[model samples]
Target: MKFHPYNLSRERLLDFYKNLLWPRLIEEKMLLLLRQGKISKWFSGIGQEAISVGATMALQQDEWIMPLHRNLGVFTCRNMPLNKLFKQWQGDLDGYTKGRERSFHFGSKEHHICGMISHLGPQLSVADGVALAYKLRKEQKVSLAFTGEGGTSEGEFHEALNVAAVWDLPVIFLVENNGYGLSTPVSEQYRCQQLSDRGKGYGMEAVTIDGNNVLEVYHIIKGIREYCIREQKPYLVECMTFRMRGHEEASGTRYVPKELMEEWAKKDPITNYEEWLVKEGILGNEEITTTRNELKQKIEKELAPNSARLGETYAPVAEEPTSAQSSLDEVYCKEATSTSETAHHGTPSLKVEGTSVRFIDAISSGLRQSLRKHPNLILMGQDIAEYGGVFKITEGFVTEFGKERVRNTPICESAIIGTALGLSLEGFKSMVEMQFADFVTMGFNQIVNNLAKIYYRWGQNADVVIRMPTGAGVGAGPFHSQSNEAWFVHTSGLKVVYPSTPYDAKGLLNAAFNDPNPILYFEHKALYRSITGPVPEEYYTVEIGKANQVQTGVDISIITYGSGVHWAIAYAAEHLDISLDILDLRTLLPIDYEAIRYSVKKTGKVLVLHEDSLTGGIGGEVVAWIAEHCFEWLDAPVMRCASLDTPIPFNTELEQTFLAKARLNDYVQKLIDY
Candidate 1:
């Protein structure tokens, strides 16, 4: 593990010394770029160039890649068209497709290269999922994910490794130990002597090699990749490299020793290997000089076109063109009809054709029907494969549909979201389930930033159905039980639906699948087992944004959804003399504004309700819409009954007290009396 040296023919070594290779020149130029103010930062793989090149060369052309910031040296050398590369380095629009990504965070669609993201450890999960996809399709390809020792600390890293190891996925995880994380030394960051030892925790085979040796890197990476493909196994390869550059371009002086700079400079891997090549007769003086000079020239030529126009390139923009697509205007549109699972079915409802289905089974059944109707549908998430998902909603999916459609994902929320986006772009109906909707927060980048805005900006329908198991009654507490419906309910371009009954779960799920925009299906974990209604064996669809008027009255409108809807109905049935109109707002954002208007017109009063907090709750929006557009139709001021602005309590008494204090649906009859 200390070092790897090879005895080879001088002629072979000389030929391998193609200094003009894109990577050699890129590292040198990037450092120059930092000095010239072209790029504001540089995280060099200076003494670590060999591992970068070795791992990259070992990958197949079709297999996608996700590399960290420092691996620009390998990425540049991989023939990622220099024009876009320079723009990215210079912070121009063209550098990254959507000027939204960081300069070092770039991807090449032409090369099947995935864009780099900020959460370093999460990319490993993405690569694992990508490799899993290849395996499912029988493609015999592998995806490589690269990160530094520092990133190995992230929980996502462990989750990704565990999934890959347990599934026998075709993925290669590479760790570049540069001995430092920002300013902290590796000794202080990790307890283990070698970072590779961490892989053992996941039951993965680990290989550690000196990163400075180019031939050694090539040898190890080549063999590992071959073994992975031949046996369909995942491997962790740690390259022990050193950094010649500081943590970043701006931190040249924040180090421990005055001699540290000189010490690492003398050990520069590129220089050391070139020298060894010449001394061993593997490379002649002319060949080495020519290769180095040519590499320098090619890089210069590639970067020259953008040196003057740096930061002037076009930015990557999202896909919204019409307000109809941007907002929840597609609640029911002509296009939705064409894409409907049953082209002729209209406004299907909960009919007891005699099937008792669990809430979770309803989700899976709805999905299965949609996928069967539309072959473009694809489902992915952690343990969704043989394990059938943590909740078993995906149980028996792999064997029934096979792996191509049903998949187990690496625990990278962002990567899972990103790959789902890509698959959506390729004309697949991507259905992503957050293992626990609580952890969906980890991929806020993909959800809020990417998935939400794709259709609004691109004018294309990104039909991604994200199912989240939300609510707080299961004793999972805090992290796993936070109610997140309000977060997306307030966001535009999203449809939020909560189905309390299995029958409604199926109908709404089908409607969600038919929607042209992204939908957030929040399933209350408490309802998954207990709340079973009659579900028909045949497929059905509900009209999104259409409220279900459970009761007809003229005194007050008790508007609610999800868990709150049931309480609203129960309260109305118990107090028929109060004359209450129980209205269930099927879709949160598009909202059945017409139904609410009808209720307000009939009763001249309204009582909005929900399980979420009153502060910025969906009820507020409905009340505001009534005030603004249907003010003449109102009789009294709109009233809202919602959860208290406090965390869901673990104690049963406190929870009941919390619900009582908020009065949510319990206040429905009271509001009617008022």
Candidate 2:
């Protein structure tokens, strides 16, 4: 609780000095490797070691740290092995990422570190999410997030700070103002004189410090960490430093003036800290030399074995099955004998007497039940708290569950999903509602690059569900009306769920919350109030990755999902002459291949329909699969129908002409006649 630096013991001071030495030596070694063509890239934090090491040392070991690309000191301070770091740099199979990622892109759940991606700004929101989890659990731990001055220019930076301030999350947003964002200087990046000043506008405690002084940075962050934990509020610390070297080894300093570089080099963090240690009598000059020599020896020993094989091609190491994957059978209820007994959270058995509920109400009821059952389940979206979301799916949720559980967020798609990743990492299940599915593109990087790959890359389960309100209807225009389930289906690690009926909406959401992976739950906006069906009041789960036979016929199979299912069923009901088989695909990714094969084989004809655009839609994937697997059974070439490859029009007539449903009857008749 004491904030004075003089109270620190000599042994602890020496340890901080050692933390500085290791990353400095490792960065030099990595640069050497880059020159030798052993490594592809190197982002050095040579002059910026004090900020990373001092801030990391100030936190409790249980607290989380989300480091940017330049924070090699944070990794070393966390005691990540030098051998693993070297192997990762060389892209070896034995590395932390198992050769899947390149330099400095790795995280360890055991170490309480969130690995960073190339996009630098999103991690701030993720760290805030982790801090939010701690606050929710009433833990005293804090989360530290690092980014450079250049990253502060991004929109996510503002969104993250605002959310953390509004929620009073226990997070430390550390901005290492290293003078340059790649080659662009601070003058061009922002008009503000001080980067930390921006944090004050968000109602957070903000400070600026000299990063070259390790003791100053260490003392300030130590106080900041305690302040965050004690007050349960966020703080922003901007440490002004310089990048002595280029962004990477290949990025030259030709753009920077020699005089400025020389001026900053004089205040090198490692040298300044080492001299301070020696002057303070904590370490002698001889001891400093000996420590540096020992670190050099350790680096040489770690890199020796991988030196020769650095550029050699090697197969990527296979990830061992994690608890999430091993427990998939139980989560998905694949082998469960009783659905009611095996439901998540041990909820009561569902009664067969069903009540007719609208699609949106079913989704809300399922979410409410999950929230009541699971203490760790959190619901977040823009205008979701008081306004009950734009669609009123979460109406009265804030009043029922309180704002802490049912939270409102800024209009930031990236932060909503990115922060959910942090919550998932901290053992909380977060359900994020996108105002509309069309806006998902704003968070595409977090979805495709981060959330989708987190589990596959490190065997860490991102147990988060993103609720996507989709499809073109109600004249919401192009921005609001889009059936983008196919975009997520194209991504590998994500599970795509597009349920039509109310029963399927409630059941699938229950299943999605329990599944230990990222799920994109696509609910058709058109069907939110329009569709109603029998839904059990008791909690239950519909198996993901399975198709339901809505109506059985022998002539042809009509494959569809979401709003498309209604069109297919209507066509079948009107024309009783053609015995149509309607197969509604509840889940898109991990498609129901067995069901498709069986239906196509029995009918010997197929018509795949969806509301997505014609090119690169789920229809193409379905048609391709049928051609490959059910080709022999096909009596005719597979027919396909989808919306035109253009933006949804506001005009009702133009919208009808552009939609796939307008031509579904014609396509089904052709498939049957063929």
Candidate 3:
């Protein structure tokens, strides 16, 4: 049942054995190192080595692989140098998470492998995206994405599979069904008997293979790969494997039931494959003995430390990176470099040329100006093409620049951000629109997990500006009307900016578009048309962390941003009875604590406000920051006048109760009266 011609020759098989040997050792070594407290953590592909080895052996060196965490086997099976792999395990800069990248987060252009994150389902889609790009690029290359069974539970799995099938992409989506997600078993995770059965829904090729059998995995992967190059039809191979260890090194095995372990342990992948190899005359008992000794000797000899760097030895530790360290930004981000040669920092003054410029036109003008200066910039979201976008902000981009630069996505948020990550890795400036701010959460994982974490991991910077039309006064219900900036404000490694005026919008946006990290640029739906201020003719940078002071009053400090700043301004302009000091926070993540302190010290009173529901809104953090930093300076208890904690009710009257401007008058009156 197991003899396959694709299995390597005696010497090559021995080499394959050598290849197969260390990855397991590496995976196990990492597991132990984690227990030993050397590194923080890693995902183990111990039992599924057959697939990584088999599938990798199926491809040529030039083809690219987009691998999930459970892909240590691919490296092992391909006989990638063990020392470098071990160094990577140690979380050293020498390790391939490619320095600054998380340990085990593998990427090597030289190896033609683009390593993936621990996130499960997106690789399936990204593999397709990379393959699509390659096909268009006319490269003789194929892409493979490896994931686990639990990843199949994700909506993106179906989305990617369907799209790849529809487009006939040159991608191989290999699902290594290891029968568990942490402690959850596959049966509980899926209704279908076989994971591969779901592929029929996509109308592409699909098959289930014995994941433990190396030759079976190899031949199946190889055949589909050839089929892909010949027909360009994507393939899906489901490897019904087992999770031989805990999810990661840090996870305790206590959650796993004894019966399940006993069951999986009986089918130990390495042992079963070895027996098969021996019975088929591929190897004798002596060679198997020799291979085991050789592997054990290497494992014992290659002892050091876990590869990943834990979040610092202490919290709030500043990593002071120099300009040279920052120069990694230049070569690392392809998009960042693309337009640098052409980008003019101080863009010449521009007169408003058009006669009938709508609110959306302003948005387009700003984007066009920024794009003109940044050639690596690519804009695509929903109907942002001839449709000019849902808001008509990008109306003529497709016609002007063509689809390659102004693309039309299939409404896949993960792919949008994921592809943007790929582009950003090569220094491209990515401006992704989420259609609306509420939908931004769909792609939030990619932004937070990959884009935001990139700089923290491998020093890979994503100069990406995620623009979203946020806020809810105009009555778009729970699904559409939500002020989600607070969510991003609380996340680390992201810069959140909510600019109020056209001038600040253009200037602050210019600065954000230039920053090295990912930025959530929120444009309140309330301010897009109504709010207007003088935008200077020439491009100028607005400091990201500094807040704008609208007034120098002594009674109270009204703190707000985005549309709320306008409300605060209006409230101040009208009622001079209590000259309340106003502070407009530009960057929420890096909150302007200095401004908060200065204003609190001046007025001895504080009122934190926002249009979002008061419960756990971003105001809470601002209040906490003020309390911690300016407690003694407070006159009255720092007050918070946020919208009542409820969804933006569809009724206009109810909606008014939840808006910052609607309720802000009362707060101002009370402050003045006090």
CA-lDDT, candidates in order: 0.70, 0.84, 0.71
lDDT of 2 by residue, 551-637 (tens): 778898888898888998888788889988888888998788888887887789899989999998999999998999889999999
Q: Which candidate, 2 or 3, would have the higher TM-score against the true structure? A: 2
Please report how far candidate 3 places residue 438 from its true position, in Å: 1.9
Weakest lDDT window of 10 consecutive positions for candidate 1: 340-349
- lDDT by residue for model 1 (166-221), tens: 77877888998887887888878889878888778888789898787767777778
Superior by lDDT: candidate 2 or candidate 3: 2
Which ranges of candidate 3 are over 4 A from the true structure?
7-11, 25-47, 60-70, 77-119, 132-137, 163-169, 178-187, 191-193, 226-233, 242-291, 304-359, 536-541, 551-555, 576-580, 631-636
TM-score of each: 0.79, 0.92, 0.80
Candidate 3 TM-score versus the reference? 0.80
Model 2 misplaced regions, further than 4 Å:
1-5, 303-353
Ranking by lDDT: 2, 3, 1
lDDT by residue (tens digit), candidate 3, 1-674: 35464636777665556666668766665666566555566777777787888889889976777777778876665556766675565545456654455555756656766676777776666576567666656665678988778888887787678767765778888898887888788878999889888878878878999887777777788888888888887888899878776787557578778897788887766777677667768889998778778777776655423222332331111124346655344333333222221111112223432233333445566677777777767776787777877777787877777776676667677767776665554456777888889897778778777777665555557677888888877777776788888787767678888877676676667776677678888887767777655554444556677777766788888888877787787777787777778887867877778778888898887888777788888888888888887888777778788887777788878788767667776776676566
